[model samples]
Target: MKFCYACGSPLIMKDLEHEGEVAYCEQCRQYRFPIYHSAVSMVVLNPNEDKILMIQQYGKKDNILVAGYINQKESAEEALKREMKEEIGRSILKQRFMRSEYFPKTNTLIWNFAVVIDSEDLSQVSDWEVDKAQWFSFEEAITQVKPDSLAQRFLNNFLQEYKIKSKDFFA
Candidate 1:
């Protein structure tokens, strides 16, 4: 930031011992380090695990996994659960962290999760954040999903390490 948050003075770059060059406020004599926002991206699967829920937001062409930023004082898992509830009104039964990566393009650190959910029918639930939502079979999901994106990386990584754990209740 050009201006210091602690004081109304111009920030100057100063190198510290542990922290590299950071913004220093002369008036406040405090250093402000650059902050990276933390976000959560999830691979949500039905109970049978063969079908994955993909969502397309307004103005986005490719369908993506449910994702959102972790709010202040909220855990990563909490954020994932909240996003799932907000996006599709479905609560995650179980979730496991897949991997963590930093996207330099967005300056965001994303934590990926593979969440097990119970609901298959999403006809009754909807969210403003998502324009459309549907369940895609594993074959369709792997093909239709965009490659080189964070969601794809997470999905690929999850599929490599774990089996599709599902128990078809109705079918």
Candidate 2:
């Protein structure tokens, strides 16, 4: 940030253990750490853990898992449920914490969650954020999905956990 949020003075870089070098306001004697936006990416799986939900956002060709940034006062689970409802009109029946990765391109730290919901209950939902959503089998996704992307890694991790042939991923 160019200016301090607490005071109207200019911000300077100061080393802080919480987040490395941070913006410091000399006038207010306050330090403001660079905030990384927290987002969640979910691999929505069917009850049988066979098919996975993939989505294509507007202006994007590659299909990706459902993702959204968490809002203030919202937990990771809440964000997951909200994104699912908004993107596919479905509710998560169960969820498991997967992993987290830092996305330098968006300055975001994405928390991955594996969620289970009845695929049969899914209804037709439309949103400006996404243009297409479909359930793809493990074989199909491993073959068609982008080889070098977070979505592929999430799929690989899921497959590995289920004792599926995860070695074939990106092979």
Q: What TM-score, computed on C-alpha atoms, does each candidate reach?
A: 0.80, 0.79
Please give the CA lDDT of all the candidate structures: 0.82, 0.80
28-67 in candidate 1: lDDT tens per residue?
Answer: 9889876788999988889877788888887788888889
Estimate, for each residue in 1-171, the C-alpha lDDT of model 2 and write its tens digit.
688877779999989876888889999999976668999998788777668888888778787888899999999989998988887888888787878998888989999887887564545555677787878897887876666998888877876765654333212
TM-score of the candidate numbered 2?
Answer: 0.79
How much lDDT does candidate 2 score? 0.80
Which residue pairs in candidate 1 collide? 48-166
RMSD of 1: 4.4
On the 0 to 100 scale, the lDDT of residue 20 in model 1 is 84
Q: Give the C-alpha miss distance for residue 64 in model 2, angstroms.
A: 0.6
The prediction achieving the highest lDDT against the true structure is 1
lDDT value for candidate 1?
0.82
* Per-candidate clashes, comma-separated: 1, 0
